[model samples]
Target: MHIHPLITDSESLKSLCDRLAQSDFVAVDTEFMRENSYWPELCLIQIGNREEAAAVDPKADGIDLTPLLDLMVDNEDVLKVFHAGGQDIEIVYNLTGKTPHPLFDTQIAAMALGLGEQVGYSNLVESLVGKTLDKGARFTDWARRPLDKRQIDYAIGDVTHLATLFPKMLERLRRTGRGDWLDEEMERLADPSNYENEADLAWKRVRISSRKADVLGRLKALAAWRENEAKAKNLPRGRIMKDETLADVASHPPAGQEGLARVRGLSPAWGGNDIGGRLMAALAAAKPLPADEMPGREERGPGLGKEGALVADLLKLLLKIRAREGNVAARLIAKSEELEMLAAGRREGLSILTGWRFDEFGRDALDLVEGRLAFAVKGGKLMMTRTEHSQ
Candidate 1:
C-alpha cells in the first residue's frame, strides 16, 4: 500500500479523503488529549484503505478539515472500520453530531472469533497480521508540535495495519458464517446514545446507593449543573466537583449559598461567589424524581442470595463451556450481571434470551435452570446432557 506524507494542508487532506471515499471501507483511528479537559482535543486523524494510508493533522495551521469530516460522517457508501473505536467515534460525534455510519469494529468482531472481549488494536494486528507493534511512542504527547518520524510512522501504522486486516477478517467471518452475529454488536458501537453526553442523564454515572426521590432529584439537578459548568469552562467534571462530594451534597444539601463554603470539596470563597449562587438555585429547583424513574432494590440485584449465587456460578461455568465450544467470547454472549439477574428469577427482558444468543447459549441456560441439562464427563471431555428433571 502507498503511504502518503503527513497531511498538513487542506488540499492533500481532501485528495486523501476523496481517494479513500472510493473504497468499500476505510480503516480509521485518532490520537487526542483529554486529561485536562472535558472535550477531547483532536491532535491527529489517521485514515486509509488497502490501497493507501495517511495521517491528517487536524491541528495544522489553517488546515480546513471540512472535506475529511464530510467523508467521515456524510459518506454513507464507504464503511468505517476501527478497532476498539469508542473514543474515536465519541470525538467524531462531538465534532459533527454524527458518528461514522455503516461502521465495523474489529475489537467487537474479535469476540465472535474467540480473540477475547475488547481486543486491543495491537493484539488484533498481531493475531491477524502476525507482527508485534512497537511500544516506544505509546504514551507520547500527541498534542506536541513537530511530531517526529517515529510518531508519524507509529500513527500511520495504526490504520495501515487495520486496512490490511479488514478484508481478511471479513473473509474469515464469511467462512465461519458468524458474520450475522456481529450486526447488532456493530450497530451498538455506532449508537448515538453511547456517546451523546446528555447532561440531564449525567447523574446516572455517579454511583450513589440512595433510591430516595428527593436525593435522586438533587443528584440529577446537580449533575446537570456540573456538566454545563464543565462544558462552559472546558474543564474535567471532577475539576469542578468530585463524585463523592457531589453525592454528599445531593444527599444533604446546604441551607443556602453561604453553606457552599462548608462543603468538603468547595473552596471557602465559593460561599460568596456566583458559582455558589448557581448551585443554590439548582438545589432549590430540585424536585422529587418520578416514581417510574426510581430504581427498585430488586432491579440489578443484591437480591441474589447464597443459593442464587450458586446457580449463577454454574451458569457462568456453562457460559465458559459454551463459549469455548463455540470459539466465541463468553462476554459476547451474556454478562455476569445478566446471569445473576437470571438466577434471581427475572427473565422477561434480556438480550441473552433473544435471537442468536438464545439459540447459542440461552436455551441451554434455561435447560440447566429447569433441570433439563447437566454437565457430564464423557471420554475425558466435559459435555452436557439432557436431564429433564425440572426442579
Candidate 2:
C-alpha cells in the first residue's frame, strides 16, 4: 500500500515514464469523467509494474502528455495491459490520435480463459489475487482538484492489482494453448479504427423501434447530426436529444419547427431552439431509403416456424453444455442471434464458424442442426452423442 507522489508536472511524468520504460510490461488504468462531455475527461492515469505504482494528474496545468504518449507508442516491446480497455484505449486514442500497441486486455483474456464475459477488474482481483478493492471513489468527480489520499490510493490500487492479475491470466492462457485466441482478441482491440468515433455510424447506437426504411433514414440522419453537434459543442449526445426523443422523431418525422415542437418527450424550448431547427433540416434532407438499403433487423431464426424455435432452444442447450465443457464464456463464442442464424443454416461470416470458436463449439452446433449429433443423458450428465447415420 505504498502510494507514490502524484505526478503533476512534466518532469515527474517524464521521469516516471522513463523508469517504467525499463519494465517488460506495465499495467495501466484511467479515471475519467464523461457524463456531461462528448469526450471522456481524463483526470487521472495510473501506471504500475511489478514493484511500484504511480498516478499521473492529466488535469494539472501545463503537464505535457507527449512523453507518456511517446513511451506508449515507441516502447513496442513492452506490453500495455488493461482490463476492459475499450474506454481507456478510446481516451488514449482521442488524445494521441493512436491506440497503444502491444495491448493486452485482461477482461478479454478472462473470457478466453473461461472466467466470464467482460469480467470486472474487482472480480478478477478477488478471484485471482485474493483481494477486494475499495470502490468508494468509483463515482467521484475526477476533474476536481486536491483529490484526497483515499481517492489517490483507490486509483493506484486499480493498476497495482492488475500487475498481479496479468501474470496469472497469462499463465492460464498459455496452459490452455489459447494464446492465439487472445492474440486475435488483442488485434481487434489494438486497431485504431475500432476506437474512431465516426458521426455517420452514430445511428447504430440508437434503438429505434420502427423497422420502416423511411423511419430508419430519418433516424440515421438525426443521429448523425446529433453526434456531430455534440462533438463540436463538447456536449453529450443525450444533452442534445434523448434516445427516446430520437426514436419518436424518427417514428413520425417533423416537417418543420411546429411539428417538431409537437413531438412527444421533446421540451418546447428545445424544439423551438436552434437545435430544433437543425433537426427539422436533417429530416428534410433525409432521402427515402430503398427497401434494400433499410436497416436490417436482428434474426430470430429462419421462417421454419415452430421447428425453428425448437432448433433455437436446442442450440441454447448445446451452447451451455459446450461452454461448460470447454471452460469458456458462451456469449464470447456465439451470441443468441448467431445461434439463430446457425439454426437457420446461414453460417457465412459468423464468428463462431471461424478460428478457435469453430473448433470449440461451431462444429458441434452445426452437427446438431444437421441431425448428425444428438444429446443424451449419461451418469446424470447431459452430453452430445453421434447419430448412427453420422457414424
Candidate 3:
C-alpha cells in the first residue's frame, strides 16, 4: 500500500477536490481524539479517490479546511465512504458545519450485509478482504508534530485500502439483491440529530445493574449533574465520574460525605467538593420509598439455575446455524437480549419472524427453539439438521 500526503493548503485542497470531482466515488477516513474533551479532536483526515490515497494534516499552521468542505458539499455524484462513520461525521459537522453529501458507511453496510453490529475495522478487513492491517499506531496522539513515517503509512492505509474494498463489498451487496438496503441505512447517517449529543437522554447510557427506587432517582439526578458538568467544562464524562463509580453511587445512595467516602471509586475531592454537596442535597430532597414498594431487583442465578443451561446452549447453536445459513452477522440478526427474550418464551420482534432479518436468519432460529431442529456431531463439526416438524 502507498501513502500520499496532501498538504493542508487551499491550492492543494483545490487540486484534491478536482480529482475527487472526476471520480465515481472516494473512500475517506479520519483519525481523532476525544479522551480529554467533550468535542472530538480531529487530527488527521484521509481521502482516497480512484488513483491515490492522501493524508491531510489538520494540525498544520494556517491550514484551512474550507476547500475540502466545499468538495464534500459539491460532490453530490461521488459517494463519500467511511468505516464506523458516526464519530467521524460528528468531526465533519464540527469542523465544516456541513455533513458530507452522498455518504456511505461501511460499518452500517457490514451490518446490512450480516457482518454484525459495532464490528471493528480490522475484523472487517480480515474477514472480507483477507488482509491484516497494521495496528501498531492505533493509539498515537495524532495532534503531535513530526508524525512518524509509520504513523503516516498507518493513517493513509485507512482510506487507501477502502478504495479497493468498497467495490468488492458493493458487488457482494448487488449480487445478494441487498443494494437498496445500504441506501436505506445511509439515510439514517444523513440525519444531523443522530450525530448531535442529546443531553436530555444522556442518562440512558449509564448502566445500573440494580438499585433501590430512591437510589435510582438519585442516580438519575447524578447523571443529569454529570452531563451538565461535562458539557460545561468541555471534558469527558469520566473526568466528572466514571460509569462504574456512578453505578456504585446509585446502588449505595450515599446520604452524607461520610457515606460518599465509603463508596469505592468516589474521588475524595469530589466527595467533599461543591458537586458532592449538591449530590447530598439531591438525595435528601428525593422522596424515599418504602422498601416493599421499591422496584424489585432482577433475579440472577447460575446459567443452569434459571432455566436449563442446555436450553441456552441449544439457543446459541440455533442462532449460529441461522446466522451462517443467512450469511448475516449473528448479532445483528438477533442480539443476546432478543435471544434471552425469545428463550424465555416472549416472542415479540424476533427478527427471525418479523422483518428482513427474520426472512434471512430469524425463522430458522425460532424453529430451532421449537425443537423442530436438531444438531448432529458429524465430521467433528456440529451440523444443524432440519427435523420433519421444523417448519
Candidate 4:
C-alpha cells in the first residue's frame, strides 16, 4: 500500500527488466499533463510487478527508460495490465518511440466481461478489489518538483490495483468465451497508430447540443487554432482556451472585438490577447453552409419519436433487465448508438449478431425488434415480455 520509488538509472532499469522477465504480467499506469502541448506531458510512470509497485520519475535528469521500454516492446509473455490504457499507452509510445506489445486493458475487458465502457479506475477498483483509492490529489500538477506524499500515494494506487483486477477480469472473460474479443480490444489499445491525433478530423469531436452554424465555424476555428497553438507553444489546450468557452464563442459568433467581449466563459485577459482576433476571423471566414451540409448536430443520436424509438426503448429496457439478471453492466449489452441504429433500420451491427454479446443479450434485442418480444411496465418497472412463438 506504500508508494515505492524505483531507481531509473541504467543499471536499476536493467534490474527492473530482470524482474519483469520472470513475471507473467505487470501492472502499469502513468501520470501525465496534456494541458499545454499536442503530445501528453509524461511526468511519472507507476509500474507494479507481483512483488512491489514502483513509481519512476521520468522527468529526473539522466533517468534512462530504454531498458523498461525494451521490456515493454519485446516481452510477449508478460501481459502489461492497465486500466483505461489509452492515454498511458499514448505516453509510452511518445516517450519510447515504440508501442508496447501483448497488452491488456482492464477497462475494455471489464466491458467485454460485462462491466461498463469507459469505466473509471476508482469505480473499477472498488468493484473488483473492494478498495477505495484516495483521489483528492488526482488533479495536482504532477510535473512540478518536490512531489508531495499524497500525489505519490495516488500514483502508486493506479498500478497496484491491476495485479488482482487483471486475473479476475481475465477469468470472467475466459469463462464467457470472450478472451479473443478482449484480445482484439487490447491489441487496439497497444497499437501506436490508434492514438494518432489527426487535427483536421478534430471537428468531429465537437459536441452539437446547443450550437449554431456561426458558432460551429468559430469552434472549428478555435479547434484548429488550438491544435496549431498547442503544437507551437508545447502547451495543453486549456492553457490557450477552455473547450467550454470555445463552444460558447462558436454559438454566439462574436460580432467583433466588442462582440468577443460579450461572450461569457472567457477570461478577461482573453479579449486583449492576439488569439481573440484570430478566433473572430476564423468564424468570419467560414464558408456559409449550403442547405445540404447545414443539418444540425441533433440529427446525430437516436431519435426518440422515430419509428424505432419505441422498439429501441423496449430493447434498452430489455438490456437493462438482462444486465441486472446477469450481474453484468448494461452498457456492455448494447450502447445507445447501436440500439438507436438497430431500431432505425440498421440491424447488421447489433452486438446480438456478433460474438459473445450476441449470445448474452443481442439475441433478445433482435427478438424484440423483430416483434418476437414486447415491452410493458409493471408497478413503475419496465420489463420485456416474449410475444413470439418461442424465446
Candidate 5:
C-alpha cells in the first residue's frame, strides 16, 4: 500500500477522500490529547483503504477538514472501520456534531469472533494479521508540531494494519455466519446520543456514597454546575471538582461561600470566590429528589435472595460453558447483572431474554434458572445436559 505524504492542504485531502469514497470500506484512526481538557485535541488522523493511506494534520494552519469530515459522516456507500474506536468517534462527533455512519468496530466484532472483550488494536492486529506493531511512538505527544517521519510512520501504521485485516475478518464472519451478529452493535456505535454530554444527566456518571433525597438533589445540582463550568473553561470535569469531593460536598453543607475553604478538595481561595458563591446558590435551590426518579431501587434488579443468588451463579457457569462451546465472548451473550435478574424471576424487560441474545445463550440460561438444565461431566470435562424435566 502506498502512503501519501502528510496532508496539510484541502485540495490534497479532498482528492484523497474522493478516491477513498469509491472503496467498500475505510479504516480510520486518530491521535489526540485529552489529558488537560474536556474535549480531545485532535492532532493527527490516519485514514486508509486497502490500496493507499495518508496521515492528515488536523492542526495544520488554514487547512479545512470539511472534506474528510463529510466522507466520515455523509457518505453512506462506504463503511467506516475502526478497532476500539469509541474515543475516535467521540472526537469526530465533537467536531461535526455527528458520528460516522455505516460504522464497524473491529474490537466489538472480535467479541463475537471469540478474540476477547475490549481487544486492543495491537492484539487484534497480531491475532488476525500476525503483524507485530512497534510500541515506541505509543506515548508520543501528538500535539507536538512538525511530526517526524518516525512519528508519521507509526501513526499511519495503525490504519494500514486495519485496512489489511478487515477483509479477512469479514470473510471469517461470513464463513461462520456471525456477521449479522455485529449489526446491532455497529448501529449502537453510530448513535448520536452516545456522544452527547447532557449536563442534567451528568450526576449519574459520578460515584455516590449517599442515597438520601437531599443528598441526591444536591449532587444532581453540583454535577450539572460542574459540567457547565468545565465546558465553559474547556477543562476536565475532575479539574473543576473530583467525584469523591463532589459527593462529600453534597453530603455536608457549608454555612455559606466563606465555608468553602473548609471543604477538603477546595482551595482556600474558594472561600471568597465567585464560583464558591455559585456552589452555594446551587445547594440553596436544590429540592429533594422525587421518589419516581430515584436510582438504586429494587426494581432495577440486583435484589437476588440467597436461593436466587445460587441460581445466578449457576447461570454464570452456563454462560461460560456456552461462550466456550460457541467460541464467543461471554459478555456478548449476557451480563452478570442480567443473569441475576433472570435468576430473580424478573424476565419481562431483561435484554438477555430478547432477540439474538436469547438465541445465543439466554435460552439455556432460562432453562438453567428454571431448573430444566443441569451441569454434568463427560470425559473429564464439564458440559451442559438437559434434566429429565426438560422437553
Candidate 6:
C-alpha cells in the first residue's frame, strides 16, 4: 500500500494541484464538521488521480487554497469524481465561491448501473475493488489537530478507492451506452444554484402539516427569519428554533408578546426579546392569501378510486421488471410517490415522464396504466404483452 502524502503547506499543496491539473480526472472528498454551526467547517480534503493520492489539511495556518480552487475552476479538461458529492461540493463552493465542473458522481452512476439507488462510497468500493473500508474514523472530530495515521489513512482511502472506481464505472456506462444518463445526473450535481443557501427559499425545508394559507404564511415567515438568524449568527437553525416549535408557532400563532410567551419550546428570554417582537411583526405583516394562492394539502397523487390500490401494486411489479431488464435501479426509475402519480394519471412535472427515465420505463408505465399493456406468466417469467384492445 502506498502511503499517501499529507499536504499541509502552500508549496506542497500548489505542487500537488499542479500535478493533479495534468490528470484526465481527479477523485475528491472532504471531511467537515457542521453539527453546531450553520456552515460546514472544512477540516480535511482528500484528492487523488490515477497516479497519486494526498490529504490536504485545510486547517493548517498560512496554507492558501487559491491554487486548488483555481485548478478546479480552470482545468476544464480534468473531470472531478466524487461519491454522493453534494455536501463536498457545497463546502468547496462556500470556501471559494466556485463549483467544480465536468463532475462525475459514483453514487448516481451506480444507480444507472443497477448497483442500487444512492449507494454509499464504502459499499461501491467494496463491490468494485473487493476491499472493505475501515469506518472507525468516520465519526471522529475532524476539527481536532494532529490527526492519527488511522484517520489519515481512512481519509486517503476515500479518494484512492474513488480513483479506482471511476474508470470501471465509466467503462460500464460507455459499454452499456448509458453515458448520457450520467451526463444528466452530473449536470444537476455540477450546478452551483443547487448548493446556494438562499434564506427566502428556506421555508421549503420546514415541514408543516397544515396547508391552510394562514398557517403556511406564518410558517414561511418564521422559517425565513430563522434561516437568516442562523446564517448571521453562525448557529444551526435548530439552535435558533426547533422545527417542532416553529410548526407549533405557525399552527397557533400568538396574538401578542404575552401570548408568544405561552408557546411551547419558546424561551422566556426570546419571547421578551427583539426576536419575539420581530415574530409578532412578521405575523402582522402576513396578508390574507387569495383562495387560488392558498397552500394545498400535500399531493400524494390524484385520488385513486376503486382498484387504484391494485394498479399501484402492479406498477411496482412493472417497475421491478423494467429495472431488471434495463439494468437500472427501480427506485431511480420511479419512486413510490411517482408510481402513485402515474397510477392517478398525473404525468406533468413528474421525473419519470421525462428524459432518460421516460425512455427507460415511463412509456411502459403509461401503457400499463392505460390498459394498453398486459402482464403474462410465460415459463415462470412475467412477460409484458400488448393488450388485445390495443391490437
TM-score versus the correct structure, for each prediction: 0.96, 0.93, 0.77, 0.78, 0.97, 0.93
Better of 4 and 5 by TM-score: 5
- List the global CA lDDT of all models: 0.91, 0.86, 0.74, 0.74, 0.91, 0.85
lDDT of 3: 0.74
lDDT of 3 by residue, 92-194 (tens): 8776666887898888778767777678888888888888999999899887888888888898888877888888789888988887756646877877777
Rank list by TM-score = 5, 1, 2, 6, 4, 3
Which has the greatest TM-score?
Answer: 5
Q: For model 3, give the 10-residue run with minimal summed lDDT.
A: 296-305
Tens digits of lDDT, candidate 5, 91-183? 999999999999998988889999897788899899889999998999999898889999999999999999998898899899999998889
When 1 and 3 are scored with TM-score, the better candidate is 1
Give the clashing residue pairs of candidate 2, or none. none
Candidate 4 residues 308-360, lDDT tens each? 68777777778788887876777655678888777766766455578767877
In model 6, what is the error at residue 13, expressed in angstroms? 1.3
Residue-level lDDT for 270 in candidate 3 = 55
Alpha-carbon lDDT of model 5: 0.91
Candidate with better lDDT, 2 vs 4: 2
Flag the better candidate by TM-score, 1 or 6.
1
Those runs of model 5 whose alpha carbons end farther than 4 Å from true positions after fitting are: 296-301
lDDT tens readout by residue for model 2, 3-57: 5799899998888888888989999999999988999999999998998899999
Error of model 6, residue 144, in angstroms:
0.6
With candidate 6 superimposed using the best TM-score fit, by how many Å does residue 372's alpha carbon deviate from the native?
A: 1.0
- Screening candidate 1 with a backbone cut-off below 3 angstroms (N, C-alpha, C), the clashing residue pairs are none
Candidate 1 wrong stretches, greater than 4 Å: 378-381
